[model samples]
Target: MKSKYYIITIVNVITMTIICFYFYEQNKLIEVTTNNDTRPIELLKKIVIDSNDKSAYNELRDAYLNEQYHEEVLFYSLLMANITHYRQAYFDFYYLLKYADRSQEMKIFDNETRLLMIEYLKKGAALKHEQSMHELGDLYMEGKYVPKDTILGKKLINSIGL
Candidate 1:
């Protein structure tokens, strides 16, 4: 029947649309982290063997940064923070997350990423990291990601003598 053929055509169109959307998203992520440079294979192998290896993380982050692969650098920074709880790594990761592109995973992690970034700032503040305290205070004042707590923000600012 003509109706049956029409239904099949509609189904095919929908399937094609889904396939196109998938490839489009993949292409977008690649475009966001575009690079013709080679990956640090040896460092990656070292990281695989020892996730807590700060040396490998530093090397990887530096290499990616030198190649202008900011997203990769951000990933390495986050890993360093998670692995070693380094104060500066936490700060770097938090700031980097702010400017991160939403070309990742259908953008589902955008809000989640912001929440994680706020948590990093909070940790950095707890560690008495001055820059983190200053930045978190401003974030609280502006309510950029966390809930607006002007009192807490002022206290943080004062604590840092800023």
Candidate 2:
């Protein structure tokens, strides 16, 4: 009986230690801070350089957006969108459309690019992405690319439980 208790106690200690280590690692990943010695952008850039860390990529995206770095926003947004970060991707595309005038400047915002962007939104919507559904619905309702369909827009918004 004493041996059994000792073994159980040892096992519990090991388990607790493992749990603590796991939480520590997770917290480390999430604890991004701007300190006097390190700028937030520099840390963000380091995180982005690693590239496999999605959370860091998201932080970088937000940072770029806050700074009005349109091109960087587009780049990170596209990356996030491709990886199923649908809402961020949709908003980024929306921002580009609403502000950048990339099409006019580069002579590329023709029918093809518009259609492509619409398709991207549709893909996200198909995945039950809320912003994509909302944006696509709005576009449909406004007849931005296709015929106006208020019903579809309402349905999309409704699906979001909003």
Taking all chains together, the TM-score of candidate 2 against the true structure is 0.61
Worst 10 residues of 2 by lDDT: 29-38
- TM-score of every prediction relative to native: 0.57, 0.61
Candidate 1: where are CA atoms >4 Å away? 1-67, 101-109
**Candidate 1 — which pairs collide?**
none
Candidate 1 lDDT at 65 equals 59
Local accuracy of candidate 2 as per-residue lDDT tens digits, 24-131: 344343433333324476576566545645666666666555655555555555555655555656566555654655546564455544554565577678878787
Report the number of the highest-TM-score candidate.
Answer: 2
**Across residues 1-162, which tens digit of lDDT does each residue of candidate 1 receive?**
989756754554354335434543443333221133344545453573377676555555555556555555555565567668877767867766554544454543345446666777788888888999999999899987788999999999999887
lDDT of 2 at 61: 65
Tell me the whole-model lDDT of each prediction, alpha carbons only.
0.64, 0.60
> Which pairs of residues collide in candidate 2?
103-109
CA lDDT for candidate 2: 0.60
